[model samples]
Target: MNATRSMLICDDEEELAHELGEYFASLGWHVALAITAEEAIAQLRGGLAPQVLITDLRIGAVDGRQVVAEARALPPALCPALVIIITGHVMHNVTAADLDSDFLYVKPVDPTEVLDDIGSFLAGVAPPPA
Candidate 1:
């Protein structure tokens, strides 16, 4: 059985967030989702830091980059949470290094592919309790 892990999805799309959260939950992940940057920050402040953080690039006013930057500023162990981005936004000159995500996938992406990437990333990473 796949070990259950926690994941956070920060997307403003209500239906998409629910769909992805349910899909990942079905795959044995404990999932939580936030619809905006402020809400996401609240979740984190409320001690909802998951093993992975999946966010949309253009969430709210601050955007995903700001989200990552804010969260990544935490203690080293808590900072740098493995982040993934799935956006329809056009990113002409960007790299993961320029953002807080370890994986960058465009919208219209397959859920299975996202899960597969998460699984592989988790296999190599030690999910912290931080």
Candidate 2:
């Protein structure tokens, strides 16, 4: 297992968050999950430097954008290698470009597709558009 492969998944839906975490962990990734933006931010600020950050766009009051900002604000070495934003309500927010995210996915997202994206990125190959 690759202990060094770590990721943070933040979502207001507790079950989905845990499910995603379990899937990633099963694949040998060190996964951290948070049900709120504050919790996610705290984890990041507390020094959990994950290589990947996957956050729901509407995560309670703070939203995923705030979490993304927090992650990007970290020091260069600590910043996530990839930022993926998932949202069921795509019309409620600005474009992915505005968030500075590597990928923007609409809800009902297939976990395997997310895994594929991460794999392609880490392999220095661009994943197909979302």
Candidate 3:
């Protein structure tokens, strides 16, 4: 099996996006970083499909929901197997369980925890601790 994993990280925080990109790349994954929602959507429309997608709840111009929707609309072969949503905001109407993503994480999350969750997903094991 091809273990060449790929990931796309969409975050409005340029520093955080790049940091996560670097972390994933160092672990032998193809990493794409988008500091804006438009850039991320464009990448997806341009056929840059990844195995995993990590997006912030609120990003420039558009929100993470739009980004995730774009990814989900892609052909099955191009859709990400795992979609992780990270947000610092407490939604007035939506709770964590209300998210339509594979995993929902609040902000102030550690990179290691995200990594572990991804690992568990890929290994077909249970998800990591909340």
TM-score quality measure for candidate 3: 0.87
Model 1 CA deviation exceeding 4 Å by range: 1-3, 127-130
- Judging by TM-score, tell me the better candidate of 2 and 3: 2
Model 3 Cα lDDT, one tens digit per residue, 24-96: 8888888998988899899999999788889998886699989999999999878888899999886677764
Off by over 4 Å in 2: 92-94, 125-130
Whose lDDT is higher: candidate 1's or candidate 3's?
Answer: 3
Q: Estimate each model's TM-score.
A: 0.87, 0.89, 0.87
lDDT of each: 0.78, 0.88, 0.84
Q: What is the lDDT of residue 119 in candidate 2?
A: 85
lDDT of 1 by residue, 1-130 (tens): 1545787888998889999999988878788888998888777766676778888889878788877776776666555357888788778888776675799988876899888887787778765553
After the best TM-score superposition of candidate 3, give how far the Cα of residue 2 lies from its true spot, in angstroms: 7.6
Q: What is the C-alpha local distance difference test score of candidate 2? A: 0.88
Q: Clashing residue pairs, candidate 2?
A: none
Worst 10-residue lDDT window for candidate 1 reads 72-81
Model 1 scores a TM of 0.87
Question: Which residue pairs collide, candidate 1?
Answer: none
Candidate achieving the largest lDDT: 2
Q: When superposed on Cα atoms, how far off is each prediction in RMSD?
A: 2.1, 4.9, 5.0
